[model samples]
Target chain A: MEWDWDFAWSIMPTLLAGFRITLIATFLGAIVAAVLGLVFAILRRSSNRWLSRGTSFVVEFIRGTPLLVQLYFIFYVLPDLGLRLPALMAGVIGMGLHYATYAAEVYRGGIESVPRGQWEAARATNLTTRQTWLHVILPQAVPPMIPAMANYLLAMFKETPLLSAITVLELMNQAKSVANSSYRYVEPMTLVGVMFLIVSLLSVIALRWLERRYGRVSQ
Target chain B: MGDWAGYLTLILQGAWVTVKLTLMGSALALVVAFLAGLGRISHHAPIRWLSTAYIEFFRGTSIFVQLFWIYFVLPMTGAELTPMQAGVMALGLNVGAYGAEVVRGAILAVPRGQHEACIAVNLTRWQRLRHVILPQALPLMLPTFCNNAIELLKATSVVSLISLSDMTFQAQVVRSQTGSTLMPFVTILVLYFAMSSAISFGMRRIERRVTRGLDGVR
Candidate 1:
């Protein structure tokens, strides 16, 4: 099939709109991942055995399951339980929860890597628990987390196409719509793939820059 | 489909399929990935380039699109396979690419001192790799391989579109028959969640055992 610049040019506007949705979903999902990551991290380290094990169980369960199944659960199950999230909300929640399992691991690694002496010093100075966490441990642990976190962010961006299953008009959905209406999978699907590749590549490159920008954590 | 007991049995059936797909696909991927991974680190340039190209091509595309290409497009070109066959093939190839990276990385992680020792002892190439290198690499590779295994297991759900009667398909069946989307989906999600959590827990235990043995060596 011949490449048509005109069709590609015309589709850009639709894909751009889809790009906006993708960005929003990725950004929002990252927020949940960050907060929930901290929660999981703390829970996994808690002195209480049940809490830590339970949290670990949750993390493993979520990690092991496919995000697609999770999405289906959120979309199909919620409405029957007398609640209905917007399709986008469902998409974002599934992405957030699914990736939170991974982010928890990253957070756990970051937290565990904090020097034991730091905790000892915190107790020596008689800092409050909150102060110990906020002032000392997090500062040390979170810096190295930036690059890994950014990588997850990009991963989430690529996963937005999976959101189309729930009827979210993300880039792939738009491409599918165009393809279905016009019967041209050749151009639309290829374009969608190319667009995703370019954006994700840029995201990865930017993340590499962030790693260099915050090398203290790793170095 | 809506009867709780009947729904239970159907999901159990689906769970069986999910297990089969996950195990079979992972086993195939492990074999292919090991070879490609070895090729990637081979002495020859062509082997290296071919492995690299394979990895990059598969990794660059989304697995969903790839599944569609193999399942939907291949039939039109006169190469016909069942949805289950195509699904397994796609999953195997896709996961193989990522596994190759893990395999290569794990091999490289083997200590350089060991490599030098092997050379000093005049061990054959295969002897050094098989006896010394792979043993060390295997344990280090366990944690990452477990991670990929879980990821690939979860991905087996993508095969539902080609009409494989996996857990996802069973959930769809219940959803269609009962119109009670929530119950069926929630049940299936929990089913998947349970299976994955069990596997991961087992993996962690294995990793601990492997690491303990490594510590003993030191």
Candidate 2:
């Protein structure tokens, strides 16, 4: 049918509430991705060949597959193995794990960009490996990573719509239910698109700011 | 293992559909990328504005929403598309928007001196683009284009929601039939990885061929 302004107004609150969940999932997922990515990057850099190769394989597997299927596997297949997660948790983890591969690559690049002299200097001072990583490496490497990491944060935010596939009450899912019951596809769906566009545009501006502020670190 | 042989056949059929969608969608994305990319750099104001709007609209929204809008909403407006049609369109258009930026960046990355050289030779704008610009820009574009293609392939998995019977959809079917979520899911996951690795490998070869004899510039 035709678009209706009043109908749109009536559904605004529900969609906004769904928007909150979408944002929360994205926020939590970004945190998970950042932390896990660091873990993966470090493990991949380990001197132990098996540990590094296994980490690399896992990262490539996650990177190669679709997030939607990963969510399915996490939500559905995990239960078969006696590990159950709430739908939102599964979605968040899946998003995080899927994007973590990309983040790991970013971290690897940042970590590698740290000059060999710095690593040598860390050893030259007789600093422990942990101390060297904590005091010298991460502090220098992490700033340059902020912009790239922020870009993934925004990317993950856009991808929150995929959470709807696992029955998460995110914006897209809310819009679908609204359209299903109300028989008005135009307004809810269009509004969902608009909501995503606005948030993404704002994130782009913020990412540009981040790049300007932190991108000079590696150089 | 013997029982899985039958399920494997079904999944392979589904993989075929996924392959078709990826191929068709990527071809469409490549065409749109060039058109919109060139349009973005065009001297005409309206062309540039239209291209920017198109790119922004597609890039800003999620591909899942785009697919649903085309699959669910479009039919209400009296235009009906088969699930496959909607899936391919959404994947192509969505990825094409991102590819356009890659195209624009690559073209812009061409050295200023090349453009100046074309101007000095009194080459027409079209000739400058055809003979001087794209050849240089193409090598740069290939790497990112490969990434975009893999992204589009992953995106086709979402079409399973619309009942497109791609690999993901077939996995769901196998899951329901055998009540074995792990097997079906793992099977499809491996299939996806294999497909993506193949794309990556092929693209690398193409990139090498394209960049041949241009190593110094790149």
Candidate 3:
């Protein structure tokens, strides 16, 4: 019940190690989300009707479902289907796959914000479709999306605790283990909460900076 | 088929719990959202500071951590809470922090001309907010509020970790008992998707109804 500084100090190393894994999972998962989300965004806008509709359905389904359930499916059912993944790998993929739906929305918004005039101008100048996208559309689209994407990064980081459910040794998992072993719930749980608070607050400050720098453009 | 049917019934019972948590949590979140959101823009500095602190602290920590702390550590400090109570509180407060921002933004987005009109008529601040500002702001808040409601629904899944026996927890129970991982997980995923879709659908209807008279203002 009482605050035990010694107990908290003793568990610091274990919690820190777990925090390292949390950071790694978040970083790798962000990469997966960024790339996959872009792919999803483009595919949803494809010329083929079936491809666009199918992509939209998949994105909607993923967005509608909970990340925790998605994590459970990837970690539990995949092994039964003869595809085993380590907890961290499964966690990363689940986080990436889940957040990708959101990131795709950001990308879609950014892409849509590029004016019709720009697309017409590209065509009038005799730019090829690919060149129009590469040289003009994306250059205009990507900047505003950065802050939204970074917000999701922080969101995924907060959710790294959920990775503990799938057995990843993230900060929450380590704290739980320490709590279980020592039969002391207060210190470790509070520490985990404090750690998350610190990281999220810092990321929020960074996101504000990003917004100020890139939030407004002439689109 | 019989065994599967039995599993479905059990999972439905859990689904009921999930629905209850989502509804109760969302109701509490709505109250907290309005309070903190309005408080943030209050005339007094301390009121604004207090709301800001409330929003930042809850928003900064993940809901899972908050649930565990409430369920586990809060009792140590003498405030015992049932799992359901804790789930509702954590989900409400956490999601409320987000809803607060939405409320603030919507209020701010109301045209500056509208505020000038309120002052020109010599309405008190409370009368202005209640009669003029809130009516306009309420419609603007609906779409984002719909999204936040879906978010709160998904968040109820995390309450399962605290042994709350929400749909996610019941799925685990079914999985362990039947030794069938896919069925339980798949069923709940569909259920969750359905619930979220329902929230969006209902919100859309309300949004349409609310904006019916004020066509060009939006």
Per-candidate TM-score against the hidden true structure? 0.88, 0.96, 0.98
Q: Which lDDT value does model 3 have at A49?
A: 100
Tens digits of per-residue lDDT, candidate 1, A1-219, equal: 456789878888987898789889889999988888878887898999999999988886777678988899888887878788999999988998888877888888788889999999999999999999999999998888888888777777767778888899987788778877876555666677677777766776787799888663431
- Descending-TM-score candidate ranking: 3, 2, 1
DockQ of 3: 0.88
Taking the tens digit of each residue's C-alpha lDDT, what string does model 1 give over B67-175? 7667655665678888878888888898898899989988998889999999999999999999899888988778878877877888888888668889998989888
Give the best candidate by DockQ: 3
Best by TM-score: 3
Q: Each predicted complex: what DockQ? A: 0.46, 0.84, 0.88
DockQ computed for model 2 against the true two-chain complex using alpha carbons: 0.84
lDDT of 2 by residue, A76-174 (tens): 999999999999999989999998898998899899888999999999999998999999999998889889888878788989998998999999899
Model 2 misplaced stretches (Cα beyond 4 Å): A124-131, A216-219, B1-3, B216-218
Superposed model 1: Cα runs more than 4 Å off: A1-10, A46-50, A213-219, B73-78, B201-216
Q: Candidate 2 or 3, higher lDDT?
A: 3
Which tens-of-lDDT digit does each residue in B25-135 have in candidate 2?
Answer: 999999999999999999999999999999989988989989988988899889999998998899999999999999999999999999999999999999999988999
- TM-score chain B for all models: 0.94, 0.97, 0.97
How much is A167 displaced in model 2, in angstroms? 1.3
Per residue, candidate 3 scores C-alpha lDDT tens digits across B92-169 of 999999999989988998999999999999999999999889989999899889988998999999999999898999
Question: What is the alpha-carbon lDDT for the whole of candidate 3?
Answer: 0.93
Q: Report the TM-score of candidate 1, chain A only.
A: 0.94
